[model samples]
Target: MSEKKSSLIPKSALTKAWLVWETFPQTCYNYERMMGQAVAQVFSCVIYYLYKNNPEKRKEAMKREIEFFNVHVEFGACIIGMAIALEEQKSEGKNIPGEFITNLKTSLMGPLAGMGDTIWQGVVIPILLAICIDLARSGNGNVWGAIIYTVLILAGAYALSYINFMFGYRAGSEAIMDFLEKGILNKLIKGASVMGCMVMGGLIVNYVSAVCGLEIVSSAQTYSIQTNFLDAVCPKILPLGATMLIYYLMSKKRWSSLKIIALIIVTGIVGGLTGILTY
Candidate 1:
């Protein structure tokens, strides 16, 4: 009774096909963070194209692609690059080299943040929002178009994650030298900064250009004094002034980011409540 138990499942055609999909992640982490995101974006675009072109099973395909981009592909490359550097240190019977690891992390994080913000928030999100908003405003409200955009975004995320995990396994320490020689980090950082500045300008116009009544109260019979210096000067001047003030405070006073953030929040709230400043 105990001997010769029959096997419930047998290996067949399905097992062979599964092996290739398992190996895909390894190829994704070979580059630095910016490069990884670029690759993920390309992959996502291709998937989107496929879904757009195909008629049958398009919905399912789009769903799967979106999941890939959002979950496995987005920041996966950076994680992969970090993992690779760590593993390399481990394999050589050496302590994770402090300087190398520190520089590698420092170098990648800024570029990655920039690239992620520019691509995801700046370009993709705005474009999608524009499309959906336009459609809605026109009274068409093409739900499929919105769905397609969403799928594209999610696909990009998943692809990034998958690529990072696998690349981390293969690249380890070697990627650092390659990354530096290629100057990919510098390019990414520069590009990201430009995008960030543009976004900041847009936000300043949209949110920070408003006026508030902060004039000192006068009991005189004849006239009232208006203390809105921002209104007197050019509308653009106020935001720039505020920005410069914060920058000066940080640079001159050596204030930490957290401290600056807290100070700004407190000042803003107090100023709003006390009518000393306006948004």
Candidate 2:
């Protein structure tokens, strides 16, 4: 039996891989492998170090890495870390199969994509934009809002990728499976969903405006339905109701956003013309 390789993968190699992924995640994007090329590129240096003694093994390893793989970039760092650890084991003459690593990567893509996209796109981006928009408006077009957003997003993306990579490297696949089996990931997703809803609700109250122009005259006194009735019943009822209606249509009825938007525009025009709804 061949003796195991004594050398360990350097942190610099892993850092380079992470940077490669961040910089060119979709640069080689295609219908065939999605992010496959990027993934292979990420591990190029690692592959060289691990299989430099065997050109055939190095080629095989590179092919395996290039197999169809796609995931949210930040959270996908965990997968990259796991792959590095697995390759190291293989290089050490451990019983790790290349197929096992490939299969694991494929299986993880969807879940990580969901988790990453939800946390970053659905929750983080909207919240950040809301704050930044408010700041810019308050500052009368201050550049700080944009600067803060750019800096924070860049810092956050790299930091998240780095942390996940290190954790996955140290913990390996067992930790990830445990995370999935224990429903911690699901719980985190649910919590993120709730927070997302709260952010959207705040955004709706802040940005979406609907005022009813409908009024009633009784006993020689005028009362705005929006002010006297709707406001008394529930503040911002029109906007809230409209927003909820849009949600219902999109979620339950499976209506396209474009259709909903068109409907809203038509309703707005008709309401304004009929003097029933106003800004």
The prediction achieving the highest TM-score against the true structure is: 2
Model 2 regions more than 4 Å off = 1-8
lDDT of 1 by residue, 34-106 (tens): 2333333333323333334545534443332222121123443544334333523333354654345445545
Mark the regions of model 1 whose C-alpha exceeds 4 Å error after superposition.
1-154, 164-176, 209-233, 243-279
lDDT of 1: 0.49
Q: What would the per-residue lDDT of candidate 2 be over residues 166-269, giving only the tens digit for each residue? A: 77787888888889999988998999999999988899999999999998889989999999999999998788899999999999999998999899999999
Q: What TM value does model 1 have?
A: 0.41
**Prediction-by-prediction clash tally:** 26, 0
Candidate achieving the largest lDDT: 2
lDDT for each of the candidates? 0.49, 0.87
